[model samples]
Target: MRTTDTLNVIAANSRVLVGPLVLLVVLLLLFVFALRVGIGQIISLSKKVAESKVEEQVLSQKLEILKTSEESALPLADLSLVAIPSENPALIVISQLKNLAGEKGVGLSNIEAKQTAAVASIFHTEIEVTVEGEMGSLFDFLKGLGSISPLLTLDQVIIRQESGIAKVDALIFGNFAPLPTTLPSITSPLDELTAEEKDILAKISSYSQPVFTEVTPSGPFERVDLFNF
Candidate 1:
């Protein structure tokens, strides 16, 4: 009877410990799964950080390149605008023509201007004028007109060279475009000016820009009071 009771007590103790052991196993499995998930998240974050670093480096390089380009490209860009004006260049071209005529010993007369729209959103001014001088001077004046900035195209020229004196009638055209109102996308890559473009800019830069002097037109000089309207 004593041996049977001892055996029954041992069985009861084993049954009581079974639930705790099972609970410990479940807790251990949950902890292991949690650790694995935490490790995976850390690795993912590390990769993201590395990628971000590479992007930052590339952006920094592009910024440096733009800074260097701004210094070198600004003058050429301004020259390009002067070469192809953003407004009607008729007056400017007229001034240049007069200067060229004076330099070439030619007389300017019958100046007329008429503006008309051309293809490519371009506006051209048709200038009809007469230049009279020696045959050589007239030819030189016409050549100078073509060489002036903002492009003066000679549509027609009627020349009468007799007795070393020539009278020429020219129909010249000058054009300009409207300025752009929209900016390009910032994400687009900047194209560096090629050698050919740089050479073209250099040639255009050599063209003489007209200088305007504020001269008082002949008028009655009268001292008016500043308070007078």
Candidate 2:
């Protein structure tokens, strides 16, 4: 009878311990999961910080270059824009051609200038020029075209020795690059101008730009707005 009582008490104690043991197991699992999540976040953040340090080094070099080259950059940029203008170069090209003809002692017999239509590449226009003069004068005029600005290129030329005339087909290039919508990333690589690029800049800088005459509109001489006047 005593043995049976002892067994019954032991069974009751075990039943009571079951709930606490299960609760402890659940708490342990939650603690482990929390630790894993915290470790993962810490590793990700550490990696980002390391990458940022490298980017910072690269950016520092670029900053130094910008500081040192600011003076030269402006003039080169201006020359580049003039070399490949952002607007229609038709008028300036025609003016240069006419001026060049006179300077080279050639008479402009017939001139036709047209902007290229939006067929494939609309970044250029075309001009047809006919000059009449001696062979030497025409040769000088042809040679001078490359030295003038608005970036003119003679694509086709036909010369008639007997008639003392030359028909020239030329292309005038323009730059219509759109402004950037977003700033570049800090990690973006900064490259110095290569030898070829520097050579191109030098050639472009040497090209002579046409003198533009701005026509200012005159106000009404008789004063149309009498009350205001």
Candidate 3:
């Protein structure tokens, strides 16, 4: 009877522990699965970070190369010329006018500037200057103005002879575009324009001829000679 009671006690304790032990084992398995999922997420995030770093490095290298290329491509003056402002042209139109008037021994009387549309489809400003002078003075003025670098065009002329002074109205056109900032790869300034180009300019001058015509007496107009440059 004592041996049988001892065995029965042992069996009862084993049965009581079985349910708790099984529950503990299931919890451990769930914990292991959660750890594996967390590790995979961390690895994926690490790989993304590494890819981003590589992309950033490549972009930085490309930026450096572009910077170097820009530095070597052109000079500051060339850049400025290329980036000309529409409101103010690269060439100083007023300064050129003053120089031309000074060189020709002509006095500027009535100078007027009016913004006009450009035929080239680009927005531009045009100045119509009216100057009064003797015939000889006007001729000298025109010659000096025409001789300016980067050529000038005389567009119109209306002249009148009055009181021993020939009154003239001349319209001159100036280009707002700047001259090439980069000169030809030649040693001398004279080589900037080719012989062919010079010849072409000479022909143009011949075609334009004396930008002014002899005064006509038929118009009911003011005697003031309006010179537009």
Candidate 1 residue-pair clash tally: 0
lDDT of 2 at 208: 73
Model 1, span 14-124: residue lDDT tens: 899999999999999999999999999999999999977877776676687678767766576877776678888888888998889889998999988876668778767
1 or 2, greater by lDDT? 1
True-structure lDDT of candidate 2: 0.74
Q: Could you tally the backbone clashes for each prediction?
A: 0, 0, 3
Put down candidate 2 lDDT per residue, 188-209, tens digits, no spaces.
8787667787778878888777
Better of 2 and 3 by TM-score: 2
Q: Give the per-residue lDDT of model 3 (tens digit) for 24-97.
A: 89999989999999999999999999977877776666566557545443233233332333344314555566
The superposed Cα distance between candidate 1 and the true structure at residue 16, in angstroms, equals 20
Error of 2 at 102 (Å): 3.7
- Model 2: CA > 4 A from native: 115-123, 161-186, 213-229
List the lowest-lDDT window of 10 residues for candidate 2: 170-179
Looking at model 3, the pairs that clash are 129-227, 130-227, 131-227
lDDT of each: 0.81, 0.74, 0.58
Candidate 2 pairs with clashing backbones: none
Q: Tell me the TM-score of each prediction against the true structure.
A: 0.65, 0.75, 0.38
